[model samples]
Target: MRFMWLPIVESVRMYLQSLPEIAETYEVDLIGNLPKGGGSSIEIDWEAERGAAETVNTTGAVAVHLLIKHRTDDTDIWRAFREQYRIQNLILQEIRRLHDYILTNLKIAVKISATGVEPLGDMVRPYYGNELILVFEWKGAIRDGRYES
Candidate 1:
C-alpha cells in the first residue's frame, strides 16, 4: 500500500508556483520541517497524515500548513497590523482559488480546516512580524492496495 501525501504536496506546490501573486510576491519554500525566521515569505510544510484501510481501498487525509509571513521595520503598530491584514487577505484569496482549482483539476477534496496568526516579536530591534497559518486538509485515496501480513 502507498500513501499519496508526497504527490499531493508536490501538486499543491506546483499550483501555488503557477500563481503570479504568490510566485512574484514572496519567497516560496517547501520545507521538510516547521519553518523559522521572520520575513515576507510563503512556506509550505506537511504537518501530518491519517489513514485507514477499508476493504480494497485506503482513505486518508493529509494536513498541509501554508505559512505566510510579513515583517516590517516601521515602529507604527497600526501600519504593521494593516500590512499583515492586507497580506492575509491576499493569501486567502489565492487559497480560495486553489480550492476551486483542486476540485476541478486534481479531483481531490481540499478544505481549510484552521487558521491562526502568530506574532514573532523583535528578531532585529523592532522587526515586528505576523505569521498566518493556514491548515489545509487534503483528502486522498489509494486504490488496488492489499495489506500483507
Candidate 2:
C-alpha cells in the first residue's frame, strides 16, 4: 500500500507555488517544507490518521498544517499585525482553489476542519504568524496486493 501523504503534500506545495502572492511574496522552498531556520516564509506540515479498514478498502484522514510567518523590525505592532492578517487572507483565498484542485486533479476529498491564529514570538523576537489547519479525508482500494488511491 502506498501512502498518500507525500503526493498530497507535494501537490499542495506545487499549487501554492503557482500563486504569485505566495511564491513571490514569501520564501518558499522547492518542495514547500519548512526551512532549516525560521524567518519570514510560508511552510507546510502534515499528519495522517488511519480509519476503519475493510478487506478491500480503507479510510483515513490527513491534516495539513499551513504555516504563514512574517518578521519585521518595525516597532509599530499594528503594522505587523496588519501584514499578518493580509497574508492570512491571501492564503484563505487560495484554499478554495486548492480544495477544488485536489478533488479534480488528485481525486481526493479535502475539508477545512479548523483555523487558528497565535503569536509566534514574544517582545524580544519579532515574528508574527498563524496556522491554518486543513483536514482531508481519503479512501483507498486494495488491488492485487497493493493499495491505490
Indicate which candidate wins on TM-score. Answer: 2
**What's the lDDT for residue 124 in model 2?**
38
Number of the top lDDT candidate: 2
Q: After superposition, how far is residue 85 of candidate 1 from its true place, in Å?
A: 1.8
lDDT of 1 by residue, 20-47 (tens): 7666766666763434554566667776
Please provide TM-scores, in order, for all candidate models, with all chains considered together.
0.64, 0.73
Scanning candidate 1 in windows of ten residues, the lowest lDDT window is 140-149
Off by over 4 Å in 1: 32-39, 52-55, 121-127, 138-149
Give lDDT tens digits, candidate 2, residues 34-107. Answer: 66445677677887565644455555677777776777777887887788788777767767887778666665
User: CA lDDT, every prediction?
Assistant: 0.60, 0.67
Query: Which residue runs does candidate 2 get wrong by more than 4 Å?
Result: 30-39, 52-55, 121-124, 139-149
